[model samples]
Target: MKWSEVCIHTTNEAIEPISNILHESGASGLVIEDPLDLVKQHDNKFGEIYELDSSEYPEEGVYIKAYLPMNSFLSETVEQIKLTINSLKLYDIDIGNNHVSLSEIDEEEWATAWKKYYKPVKISKRITITPTWEDYSPVSSDEIIIELDPGMAFGTGTHPTTVLSVQALEQYLNKDDLVIDVGSGSGVLSIASVLLGAQEVHAYDLDDVAVESTRVNANLNKLGNQIIAKQNNLLDQVNLKANIIVSNILAEIIVQFVGDAWDNLEQNGLFITSGIILNKKQLVKDKLEQQGFKIIQVNEMEEWISIVAKKVL
Candidate 1:
């Protein structure tokens, strides 16, 4: 079989949204090549076993690559992706050059090409996300390992948004508490919640692909029984109350359902939200406050921000 590699040259600000666009367009297995990663300092405490190549990255901006099966609708799909990316301007995102290119490759080559970009990294104090292909062992008995094969899903469990959510969950999740993970991409947070002693987790995602990915990762970590992965919109039909609710999604989408999240949580229940850019941080915070949530903590990593609020009313 043949595969086409679609590469987009974009800015860091646009990575999350553009990646979502690609995933929604039927692309599988994404690779992000950010030039900043070359100079960024990584802590040796987690493990610095993987080597990187400086020559493979662009001099500026970032490149996001994904694979799509070469089929009759390939051209149409690519066009739609471009159109959707252009639509991101409505959200005030800076798309940079927005140059897109495509190349053909053998299935064998495409299968393993993305592995070099993914490695074991400790994202938070207790959580480390490692690709399934890597051999990673925990440095401590208390460390939690999330094995993910992102496949075509949006979450790798290493993104700043995800890291913030997991770290917040670590600090706030009570033992045997019920967790509601909205936009549970790859089910990483649900698995983390269970690992952190949540009795049961209800993981929800609107994308069927993400729902399956979450289930796959949950079972990979041997926590499938503890996480109920389902395809559902954000808190629209949710009736059961949870001790804590976590969402690592865009601030725009999050604001739309802030009220619903408030209604779904038990009194004083924790609500953690990420995937917000620095510029939009205040906006999301204000929305949560308007919905009767009290802001408890604000965490930031790189250009991303995560706001943790509590439903006090």
Candidate 2:
């Protein structure tokens, strides 16, 4: 089979949203090339090693690449992706150069090309995200490792949004607590919640590919028995009350379900949300507050933000 590699030049602030656009447009397995990664200092406290190649990254804006099958609808799909990216301007997002290019490659070449961009990284104080193919050992007894094969899914569990979500989970989740992970892409957070001692996790994603990916990753982490993976819209008709409800999705989407999240949680239950750009921080905060949730903490990493709220009513 043949594949077309689609590359987009954009800024760091647009990474999360643009990646979502590409994923929704049927591109699988994203490879982000940010020049900052080359010079960024990574702490060695977690016993992780980095061997970055500066030559592969652009000196200015970042490059996001994804693989799409060479099919009859490829042209239409690419056009729609470009249109959606342009629409991001209304959201006050800086898209930078916005240059897009495409190239053809064989399936074998496309399969291995994305691996070079992924490696084991310590995303938070206790969570380390490693690709399924990497060999990594925990340096601390309390360290938690999540092994993920993103495949055609939208998450690698290493994005800043995902990192913030997992970090919030580490701080707020309690032993034997029931967790509902909305937009459970790759099932990373659900798996992390269980590893952090949650009694059981319910993982939901609207995308069938993401639902299957979560199930596969949960099984890979040996937590399949603890995580129930299913395809469901965000919090729609979800009546089961949980000890905690966590969502790492767009701030807009987050707000849409804030009331539902509050209603679906037991009193004093926690709501953890991320995938919010800095610009949307206060908007989400206000929405959560309007829904009777008290903001417990707000976490920022790079251009992303995560809000931890509790049901106090």
**Clash number by candidate, in order:** 0, 0
Tens-place lDDT digits, model 1, residues 97-158: 99999999899898887777778888778788898888989999988888888776576776
lDDT by residue (tens digit), candidate 2, 1-313: 9999999999988887888788878888788888876665544333233676888889998999998999999999999999999999987789999999999989999888788777898877888988899899999998888898878656777677887888788888889999999999789999999999999999998888788888999999999999999999998988988999999988888999998998899999999999898999999999999889999999887678999999998
Q: Which candidate leads in TM-score? A: 1
After superposition, candidate 1 runs with Cα above 4 Å error = 42-50
Off by over 4 Å in 2: 42-49
Q: Whole-model Cα lDDT per candidate?
A: 0.87, 0.87
TM-score list, all predictions: 0.96, 0.93
Candidate 2 vs. true structure, TM-score? 0.93
RMSD of 1: 1.7
